[model samples]
Target chain A: MSKNGFTRRQFVKAGLLTSAGAAVGAGVLKPTGLWAAPAKIKGPVKVGYQAIMSGTLAGYGEFHKMGATMAMEEINKAGGIAGVPLEVEFRDSTLKKPQAIKNARYFVDSWGADFLAGVDSSGQALALAPVMAQLGKPLMVTHAATEKLTEIEVFKKGIKEIFRICTPTYQDGNAAAFVAQGLPAKKWATISPKYEYGYTCWKMFKGTLGKLKPGTEFVAESWAPFGTTDFRPHINTIMDAKPDGLYSVEWAGELITMIKQAKQAGLFKQIKHIMLPVGAAMDVLEGLGSEMPDGVWISGRYFFMFPNDQRNIDWVARFRKRWNHYPAYVSETGYSAMFAYKQAVEAAGSKEAKAVIGALEGMKMGSPAGERVFRKEDHQAMYEVPWGLTASNPKYPFKVMGKQVVIPPVEFFNRPPFEGPGTHPPFKG
Target chain B: MSTKATYAIYLGIIAGLAALGLLGDRFMVYMGMRVMLLAIFALGYNLLLGRTGLLSFGHGALYACGSYSMALVNLHLTQDPLLGILAGVAMAALFSLIVGFFCVRNTEIYFAMLTLAFGMMIFSLIWNLREITGGDDGLVGISRGSVFGLPIVKDGQFYFLVLFFFGLTLWLVHRIRSSAFGLVLAGIRENHQRTSFAGIPVKRYRLAAFVVSGMFAGLAGSLGAMLQYNTDPFSAHWSHSAEPVLVSLIGGLQTFSGPLAGSVVFVVLREIIERYTQNWMLWFGIILLAIIMGLRGGVMGGLEKRLRQRAATRKGGE
Candidate 1:
């Protein structure tokens, strides 16, 4: 390898020669196409990142990238992952699945990425998660919330290269459902963006809530298409149903639009209660602000203020000081993915994908979000999910999640290895 | 030179370029395949807009239909990439035929709206149908299988496969544009009322053009889906459809090579701008605005206009 950087030609040539050499020594050849030993690298631990860095979804992608950037900077400053400096190459996924997949290949086949990370769209993640087996590189999914990554049939067939550092859809739904069960109102309705994430969110919430409260009725449900700017009709339909409570799962900018419209109409006031678990996130909080109605239940995977542990406080302080904004949950997840990677790389004492996977399989690490343990069964990181009622506080300028409650991991979340990755949360609901 | 010689020269140029792409850097091979496939897509789109004088806002859905059919067939039906590609083409043509029947009756904006409506219907179907279409996740785990006996597992090999089709499509486009059928289509585009007075079936000719455009776009979409081994619902979106229209317009509408030029410019510009900053859409928007304003009839149209003026000036001097 050259001192500067290795060209794709050289890599291909070297690979061909090695394979040819192995063929000459037929007795020594291995079953797997590649040689058993991993290549020794002398340069930075390069990460190929894909996210929506442009267009409407830029903020989410930017925060995710920022988290990753801070993680890389911190790691390098402290002496990098396993004494090798870290490098990250960013590509705009344009919030599209095909683009994300293409970027994944380009990063490996073209950018010579050591490991791949980052995606903001659950749609991107759903398409990308299954194809990880072919990439043969560890992809740390930091932002996308699709449980389908681990729960889907193809993924259940044993995909190893894929891992998520963020909360999955079901877990978020489970916590939301668990919280909703305590409410006085038994009747509920759902208004969410139509997609896998929304489906999974409502399904899991309804499933868990149904099991808990057998009489609870889902009085109304409406699904607005993703990136929908107008939510008037959907809101009107939900109001007409007149359920005592509402379950919402909109994301980013669209969520803000939905809230503003819902508020304009007397929908929030008419409904006894409302639940927008993701809508209470920093982005929505910052955008909607005083417009965000009071006395409603909401949650974010990370609230930046909660946990308030020394480690988290310092991380947030540093992040805010640098980025000039409070760290979004996506930032925390992206940051943690890198740190988990650093831990795994150092623990394994190599950058080999297999070695890193082995080290990270069941590893427990404290993250800014909270304590996280990558469940060996499904390779999903189990962490505390922070949920709270949407309330304004004097200390913070934005909508503060009051009555803060951290939802512990569901029992079924961490399955025994013998039973397999566990059955996907039943679709009986 | 004879027609056969001209055809041979075009094939030769394409083959040479394909060989160069195979030996070029990874991005060149990757982006080159994308450009070629998109160029193919734009060719069909330009036929409707420039040759048939029919504006379609629905080819993105047609393109998506192509890629999705290819992906689904590969994933569930067969391992043969050829079969998947054929399935893609057939599906796209069928979609266009159904949509075109209604779309071709009206002219201009009505036709545009009809096509757009049909296109969004496909988009909604793809978006809402989570089980078979994989919803927004799209169809994944598609493989580019061996062709007859030759393998096409590598990017270089895939580039050659696409190149062969690119040449074939070029020849087909040339033939269609030059034939009596082509003359009738052009006549309809220029003055439909006059063509009707001449006793030509204008609607039938328009439908044929629409089908032809759909087939070519479908072919490109299938190859593109195979190129990535992935296809998403976005492929079937209005935005995807807009891509071909943009390429044809920017490269110069009404020019045979305009779509190809536009596709090359569009892909290369995005690739180049994306390298420096994530805000490629901003720069791209600005560049496209400038090109549309400065070049007017598109880059190729402007060039042709200049050439015509130069010929006129020379003749005046003589």
Candidate 2:
């Protein structure tokens, strides 16, 4: 609404209402005619998606696009959702927070997107929470693995419209701790990124690992800032500490750099047991190639070769055939999010944001990643992901996960109210 | 154009922008607010580049200082936007004065390099001081509380607040550019040695212009943080510093309103192109290349040149 007491949006909406009313009335008048029933769903449900589309991380955006595009085509081909077509528009959110917010506004206000999806950075995800509330639209986060978006924003702040289709930091933090407790290594040290994501994951890993093993000692820690290309000093710190085990939460290019440097420094040989929370990421594996030493334990939000189910295999084959490249975790999550939206929209029988959100709560759907259920408490999708040791494989160019260990979401995910011993993960720091 | 006509044109633009804030939809208002902030930043920046002929790359440091100071004040002290603005502007002015004291000692490439160095220093400081600055995640959840008891929590209302500041900055910059001090600064740009021989403290004038330019950057930065509801360390990065320099260059380094026109094209054009293509940066780069190469001077400079030639032709015909 403007100062003049009306807006073009309101006027168009009113006109639509009148015409819809007349159509309903005409349908009622023609009981025996062809137009007996009015359409229960709206036409052309618009979804706006955003992701990092430039710079070194630009590949993430391309993979995200492939999955979402494939899902959109598949949905439309199947007579769309509830007899109405699904429209999706992808915008580059970049790495900047302002640009991310601008893209969100562009989606809802300019492009008339009813539901929003795909954010790559935790900063962008957290920032968009307030704006999503203001816009009164549902944002399905696909890539960003921030715990705060669910544990703090949605669960505590009660921002109902926020939902995560992918696993949060628990997959990177607590899940790794669950995997670590099984190993015999008693002393641990880490070389992680020097930001919130790194801090949170390291904290979760150490706390949970200590809780699980009772006598585990965190020997030394090295925090590498963003854009860190060298890891010799950090590796040396870990080597000097002579920890029985090592943990690192670094991801993407930085992780690749750290591993390459660590391999060169013989740091990998020095520590018999090592864990990389995000080491199974496609980019890291692809980047490291043969340089990525075998035997390090790793896990990710979604691994394309996981579950090993027929559905997973078929989806991976299709994705590879279409893209001529392996599906990254973001690709899987992006594809799954589209289907999630479709199921919610069709279940609710409406394209309205509120209706879709209501339908999405506690909804269970089978995806390439196996069965995923959106937790009613925090809207964080709960599922199982496998942690495994890296090993050479002839089937793929890079090392594949061997001796996989699966961690259930309920075992480690921070519960609602996110505080105290029972509800939250052990908080020692 | 005559003074009266110029005044009228400025008034018209202000009125038009105000109308946009009142009548435009949410997105439009938000975009309008962005353009106004850029305009404010560019306007002040042009004072140093166009009026004084000095290029200081460290203005972004001043901007970050202002943004962080204002955000800290709002977060800890008062939610009053005016007080935040004052804190932002004061901090920027003080910081710029200190930086200008050193930077104005040299001219040309040396000064530019000095400013760039300072800018990156601030960026690293902001990045490393994670406890205070929030690291790369930035300071989020900032609210536009109110202006003298009038709530600007809504972006539409906040648009008016930015509009007021934009108008104020424009008027101030215009006054500075046309004043006697402006001419002396222009003299300094044309030839500092000659200006110094004429008994004017050339370095003092340069320092003054630098501080004023920095003050403007601070104002824009403070408002920008409020508008975006956050401030990040990137705001102080050299890449961020390049925005004003690029805007001034593309708009016209020699014209008063050149950077203002450039900012409009810079922001709006990118927004429009982004809607059409995913590879917006490539297309935007191509367009900017054409503008920079084809237009000899900037957009405003080229237009002014054409107008001058046309007037000369009319006189010859008469």
Candidate 3:
């Protein structure tokens, strides 16, 4: 035996043989086998991100990628979740539910992702609830603001894996009604999208506004279909009704078109108090540019200018520098989702689904959208996003929100046992 | 290939799929299921496009008919997957009969446009009929209940069911392709005017082919809905209709196994490209363009030509 308890010849033989064996093993074996170990916190933290990466809505995916990539870089730089390296793979979800499910399955089953994030469409989000439950991975929904995802899937159906970092339809409907109640305009008219989203929001807005301020009338409503490029008829219908206030749930390019057509038709002049629940969306604001009329009440899932904290302000600057554009509401949500995952993973000290979910439930985290708390009941993140009046800012090329109205999320968010009178979407007129 | 060799090849393929179900991971099994479903769809679609030389673009509506009917059955009636699938087939057949009646009168581009119009109409119906069809959100939470006491909710378990259906579709399509009706359809494709002059009802044959093709699309859609446990109006969209066309084009239109080969390449390649890059569409488009441009006859077509040449050289050597 040598000084190390082995003879010199034995040591040399062992070292050379071991080196040869290792070289052979490295070539033959899967890398996953080399790294994988049964532990509470082990292996690289893998996140499978999916978003609309095709068609007209593809821009949203890019914004999501920007925010998520930034978070990933920052987290890795800061030593990652529980000292494990964080990795994210982005897939194009394409607004198709099957494709979304396939992407998710590929992430969790094939790629062995610890967490999932970034769904763009409400339909796709809702469709994923069962699949996510089956996959048994935490899905931190960054966008896809269908209340049904939380209320129906997570709350009623008890699919605990689903969690949304972004605000739901309450921001578009109940919160809009909360802000609108303060206005002198008692009679409200709407030109909304002709779908479940449009209908649900209009119903919620009417129900809440009526409750808040009695004698509030939904005088008239016009609904435009999904791909309505022309809104002249919808504007004309609103003009004929001649209500005191106009509330529209038309979002994205549709909102831009509606606003442009309304402006041309002088419908904005006719209706002095106008409210667009999704008007403050960066796409709509940017698309309309200087053409977007000022003083119109608008709200979004997030407003970059509001939450005027150092964190949010710094984030906006960083995002602008990184992407050369103002952060869309989805960007903030996407960024926040990564932080939420980090916080939960670090707190739990485990990448296991149940542990991370337990860590997430009722957990509070600071974000660019201000302090967000994942609701214990439904896994919906309760966060503050202001409803404000659209105004021009010297800093921006497009219209910005000026007079901000921040509503507490709990007041507008549907409580658990969501079937009751107050908790429901006022589905019955 | 000899009949025995063809049978052996099909058996080998089925065995491979069965092995995949038994041994492959969740994602592989799931993707295998998808490829099988698309293969079924493309096989039936090739009956019209390859066999009869008629291109109908409204097959997606028929596909949607199957999916929605199955989902509706699951939601409202019984949770039996078999019954739901049958309902899908029935609905797809009925709708296709109606659509094919109008479409069979015209040939070529006019037939394609009629099908497109009909497909969009169904799409609009699904989109507008919120209460019944669930509108844009569609019907979610479709239960994959027990089939013969075997739980199929799991991807690996459900894969065998898809494999079984895939085998059935392949066999059925093979039978149809070799039948007298298949010969008549081929003759019509070569010269419908000449076939009509020979006292054959060309329109009836076209309608039969269309309905049969639609039935296959519906079967694929039904199985697809079961696999995913959700159905949406997008299934009825014109874009969805184009998938079978693309698959058929990719596999080899004239060959029997063209769609099967095409489905595998199309699905697997898209998935692989998507895994690597966010610009998967661009990459997939480029790859698809290369395949389409380089191989005029598709992957199977190219394979057949090479195989024939190899066999000729072997005979020359002999």
Candidate 4:
């Protein structure tokens, strides 16, 4: 009833307020963050996340927080789960395992968080696995790609309550193999930093690529100690191998530094084919920028330019609009894990750990990465890993995953959605 | 005040705090346990740097050895947590026997560098040995079982246990400071050449101090791992070794109660700062610099001087 208008009865008889009130109410729902509804949920669902939030790997944490905050915000604004708002808490791991485990416990024991997620370091993830069962809460690993986390190691100890939304390291190798199938250069050699991650990824890539393309003569292998700054000697050794193609398993800052060294050594000009399994990651692309030379084959867990779906485009646009940067693969992983947790909570219709675990088993959800299903048996998500050739464009800075080689999840996985050799299963599920 | 009286007052304060914790927050008890453990670490570290004039840069390796030994034994061996704790200290002592021999042969910077090299070696080993040590992934699932037949499921009980150990360690340090052996170590710290001339085996005394300090550190490490529920190679890294040194410096190396006060302040400050800002490390650095610069001889030294001046003035007035 307007102030200057007549009585409410007369106004109602004239139907003066109904249409206006309805239109305004409809407008209210259109904007984000105005979701107001009576909650069916009993209480607020609190999520605690641990990651490498300090030291050299803090950027990873930044992306993780951004992605996680985005999801939590969206869900909360969209009337929340069962009409109850979601909350998030974060702690820095300092890139150390003990700190991560302590942080996880603090969240569980001290803060009474409903669930846990966000591990950036593979070491931290592995350490958190067995303890997660003791903690009795689900730990959805957002970015750690180590195979043993979901495979025989956890199985050996009979550990559960651990699920990974990101693809495993073996899948990265498989994607590298798929891309190698199209290249003309047959002669091959390997160069990589010496570590479990490097050794496993290169070993699987060799096996798969060799299986796909025969007569790929193994020439030479050069290994660099982890944290080796000067790559001149390693580059010289690779050039001396005189292979037509080279596969290097390295990532992040070390990879970026070596690429500059390789350019100075002119190894890219010398070799007709070259590839790095993680060269196209958002950090790698944005990190190298114009320094990322042309013609090198690279891959990412998820690249912004690949597939070009409308959903992905919208996600990327919103990310750029918010962070002023393309969403990294790790960002997508964090984003997906949060959504998966939300779905599990909604499907269970309760926030109890056991109930959520039951609901999450074989639960299906959509993500910016793509549609993914959480396997009931081993708790692994079967998702695609894409690889592509590097190309420069005047429209934007940094290398785009141009000439994209989209590898389907089925090609690498052997009878997935349960047990797969790619997931490093000890036995057939 | 007399040193004995000071200790009596300190004990009374601790007992009061423990009593208050029975009705207060369990989180406070846990924090108290952490503070006590840190004091133990600083106490062990001070034995070498303050009493013996030996600056070791490799305490991290010994510290980590203690935790790993405890953690592994708890996971596999007897449910008796006391045995694990003893084993942890024993392992560190044994390691000290080997490492201290080489380290004690040198003095000053050479000794420091030797300890550093050894520490880094242990760190790398922990980082690489994925099969046995779990590499950087760390050893998890450490059991927080009982020492005797008494079960410790409550935070209050654990805090009391830690307090008991801390009091014991402090008493041990007190005894060592007044004993003949302790005087010889002090003499060696003052003048190793003169002490050698006075028919004392200076090198041997230094080595013994190193072993004893390692044992104390091991005890603290084992207790820390049990309380925290995990131990990693990062515990063996050089930076972890620096913590006690920092505490000893910020407190007063010469004062008996300095380590405890410093530990309480450091832990409390860190926890509180973490709640406020993500860049707490920066704030920590600023506070550390202020303490280092503003205080004359660390917190204890400055406080003691003020007390002595006040006593002199009161005596004059009387």
Candidate 5:
């Protein structure tokens, strides 16, 4: 050792030899010895986003990508996770199962992504769940609302990697049931896209209504395949039933198409109240425009006007500033999911998967949607589900929620002893 | 060269693919299995398009029929994978027979369009009948069970099973292409009226080819269903039907192994392009346009043609 830590000859001799050989004698080696730690590997985190990126439901995928990109940019700005920059590896599921499965494998293998995210369709999500389990990688689902995802088949079958940001279909249905109870409607007509999510929504809504209002009856039900451009037959059938109110689970372009057809067919004027469970999206509302009608009850995962908290306001402002449009509940759900992941990671203090999973389960975190907690029992998020009457607003380009009600987590959630298996209603009608 | 050389080449390719699959990780094995399955399906489609000159756009319906048959069999019947696949093939053949009887009457675009409409009808029917078909949720929880007597759980094992079937299908198609019946079909393709005048029942041959194609497609579909452990209405979509057509065209429709070569290229290209860009379709469209214009006879066809030209020139010089 010399004045500059080593003499000129000593430094030259050390430099002449490989680092590993010097370490053998001196017991001194840098932690990441000679590797240079790979200068911030350029390339997005390769998030294998699978959604209906084409066809009718393309907007949902676009919104999801927007929300994901916004969160990714923020995360990168704060010096990315352990200095590995994030990137998105998107695959258009085209709302098909085979394509979804194919994309899942491609994302995991070809794209070299350890983590996976993004699925809009419940069908697609259910298809991907087992594959994710098989691969032993975490898939952060944002938009799919299937109740069965966190149930026995997936969560109990050694698939602890799946985490959902959206409320389960049952929760959305229960919220609709809660809204239905406040209205003067007793008889109900329901129409949902004929699939798992649709069937589950109907089942939960019926079950919740029966428990809350014993006298309430389901007068009629109509199920249509998704992307059914001609809702005329279904609409006619619903109108002919003449129930006191209608419960609808249709959303995105399908919902917009139904509304336009129904409005033109004079179906909205006849029904006392329209309980559109997913009608709160700005896309749907904007498409419907003034024809959305007043006093129709609507519930969603997020309402831009509901929370009024600093987090919610700031999120909206930032989202508006970036996209030049109001963030829908879908976008907010994605934003909340990213924040939830960040919180879980920070809480765990390590990116170790098991630690982060433990942190996530039953963990409470503040989102722009308000205080939400993931139930340890089933991994379902419990939070303030916003419901309101849809009214035309001049201040905004589309229909906005008015006369809002925020159903507290406790009021809506069936707290543990949460049924460890099977399904349970989240709210009383 | 000789029949032995042809068989050797086919076996060599299969063995090489198996070795490659075993060396790779689970993801590669999975992709390899997918490519082989698509190759098998495209080969089935090729039987009609390549040999019979009958373009059936509703091959996806037959594929879905096979998949749904397997799903139903897997759920209701014994989980014996062999029996399930056989059941799928049988059901698909039966469906093709019914659909082909009416469809074979038309030719060209009319036949294609009719098949498309029928395929979409089946798609909608299955999608709408949620109680049985599981609706859009699809039939999940399908166990892939043993192949023959061996437990086929690993991706590598499944890959060999796919390769085995793919080789068998290729052999069968090769035999069919060289048969006297193949000659008659070729004659029909060149001139249906002339073939009809020659006392051959053109409609019957076309329908037979369609059914055979459907059976093979069903087999591929069953393998896919087993691999994915689920099936959906998308398998029956018009897009799925068009995949084989695209593969056939891209590989050179005239060659026996064109679809197989095309399937590998198509799947690999898609995987590579999708990794870099989300707008894979835009890139795929551009590449496909280039392939179509630059190499009219497709990859193998162009290569074979060039080799023949080079050999002829060398012989003349000698």
Candidate 6:
């Protein structure tokens, strides 16, 4: 026994005393109200942005952050939203769902964020959705493309706080089907990661293809685990099927790995056409470089070259200047989402969650991608989704999308057979 | 008399904490639930590491197995929350039985590596099995069920439910620690050969401890799954498995309450540090290093030892 030593009893007593002191201190201390102090209005309306700040998906997170920062800067320079400046409180999700939820809670509960925004992974977005619903906070999901999010099973069944700005997986699947239908491809084989996003993409593409061209034989379907580095076996299986075309839904590192492996194995040359649902990212394209097999069609959430609008051009230029690279669909989607949030806030004329949600529903907001609106019936964003043919470009460092077409949102998004009961207060016309 | 008083005091503190958690805002309530859950997990880990001297690097698999079971049961089977939890526990127990059969064979590092291998295998299995487990997208849109037939809709109600489970787990662990089975485990930990010579089945005792630990961990995991409203493959990852080990080590592996204290401190610190800076790992590493080097017996263990010493010195002076 030492002089500084205290027994468990003493320590417990001390802990209780400390807790009592804390309680008293809390009572005596001047309470800070939930809302930010009006007099402390700074340079901007600080929007705490938390996303995957680092990891394998670091590049995408950085791009999304850059996009949000650019949007904030642009909005502030353009007299700001509702005459108040906009700033961003950037937190890192580290590409983990738990961390994403924690950061979301912190942003809303502690930082007093005006709006919650940005998500890269569908799982992360889904995890944060319930919290957003509970908090009655508007979250503009920018990157995650899982259609189940806005479906009746999820959002309509009381989780109505999520507003997906990115094109849903179903939309991308339809775009692929639309492209595939026009091509001289009869049999289709699919290799997608086994997840909601990948599975949904596969199902929707197959279903859409079936609807478009009857008697299209589905030769083979290989479901690789997400983040599986080895695609050799799967590629071999796909090649063995010898389908006229291939549909690949693998994205990020897995996609990069598959593309390189497929190119080496000469699988790309054998298939008449390859439709990668998520290979349109600038990072992935750049990573693939010349190895990104030519003539393959791909659909993405955004393509810097697809939109010929001045807004799109300006956004690309600004983003390029800041990030030192072409903006991916994710970055563009994030940028568009923030702008959309501002539009909704302005339209609602209040920061109230329900009011803003009402303002967002069916309200068209202009972005570089064009006027995108959230279908009031379901919260799915309705807009032009970009699909393009892949081609090697010496002018740029990476592969670029060539001969692109923007699929109208209405053409693909199935309106009826909503997944869940609508909990969002009925649209007041 | 001292033990009884200590028990009473701990109960009082726990009750007070629960009340505070109920009264606190949503953020506090959420954090409180997290702490309770983590504490329950750490307590389970402590049974093996602290009392039984068995270090498991694969408990996360059991935890995740329980969570996924809960998710599966909740999604596909009956949404009866209690039934879902029971299903989770049952699955975890079954998983532990299989893994523990192979794991309890070796000693020290071999045991650890075997557990790690098993845990990693489970992680890979969960990550790859998309149809059943949802793979990377995870099992989403899970309904948070009721507790003991009571609606756990509100944060306060959920907090109490978590506290109830947490308290139940704590009491169970305490009872086990003080029981004759616990003494046998301690004997096996202290000297396996001597225990065997004394006609005790060292292997059986060790396996029993592992099974009990797994069951409690499963309960915690199931609760966590319900709390998060989803279960991802990460729950089964080696990193998650390592968390309990870290919690136990940091809290000091000497006492029953060490892991509980460690979990509380670790989670709270993580939350506070994350709020201030994004580079939390650097700070965390530094703090953990300081604690390990400075405290020796871990934060709580060192504190308790010191307190006992001071009380002894005062008694001697008197």
> Could you tell me which 10 consecutive residues in candidate 2 chain A have the lowest summed lDDT?
A29-38
Model 1 TM-score is: 0.88
User: Which residue pairs come into collision in candidate 3?
Assistant: A2-A6
Individual DockQ of the candidates?
0.48, 0.57, 0.64, 0.35, 0.58, 0.37
Q: lDDT for model 5, on a 0 to 1 scale? A: 0.80
Interface RMSD of 5: 1.6
Each candidate: RMSD to true structure? 8.7, 6.1, 6.5, 6.7, 5.8, 12.4
Question: Sort by DockQ, best first: what order?
Answer: 3, 5, 2, 1, 6, 4
Error of 1 at B171 (Å): 1.7
Predicted candidate 1 versus true structure: per-residue lDDT over A18-39, tens digit per residue: 7787776567655343654453
Best by DockQ: 3
Which digits, one per residue and each the tens of the lDDT, describe model 3 over residues A1-429? 447688888879999977776776678864354343335687899999999888888888888888899899989999888878899999989888889999999999989999999998889998899999899998999888889999899998999999999888899889988888889898889999888889888988898888888899888989899889999988888899879999999988888888888998998788999988888788888999999999999988898997999999999999989889999988888888988999999898888999999999999999999999999899999989999988889988999989898888777887888875767432332
Report how closely model 3 matches the true complex, as a DockQ value: 0.64
Off by over 4 Å in 5: A1-47, A82-88, A155-158, A392-394, A409-423, A426-429, B1-5
lDDT of 4 by residue, A146-194 (tens): 7777764444455668888888876667667777878887878877876
Residue pairs in collision within model 5: A44-A86, A44-A87, A45-A86, A45-A87, A46-A87
Cα lDDT of candidate 6 equals 0.81
Order the candidates by lDDT, highest first — what do you get? 3, 2, 1, 6, 5, 4
Per-residue lDDT value at A171 in model 5: 55
Worst 10 residues of 3 chain B by lDDT: B152-161
The true-versus-predicted C-alpha distance at residue A323 of model 1, in Å, is 2.1
**Which one is best on lDDT?**
3
Model 4 residue A75 distance off true place after TM-score fit, in angstroms:
2.6
**Residue-level error in angstroms, candidate 1, position A182:** 2.8
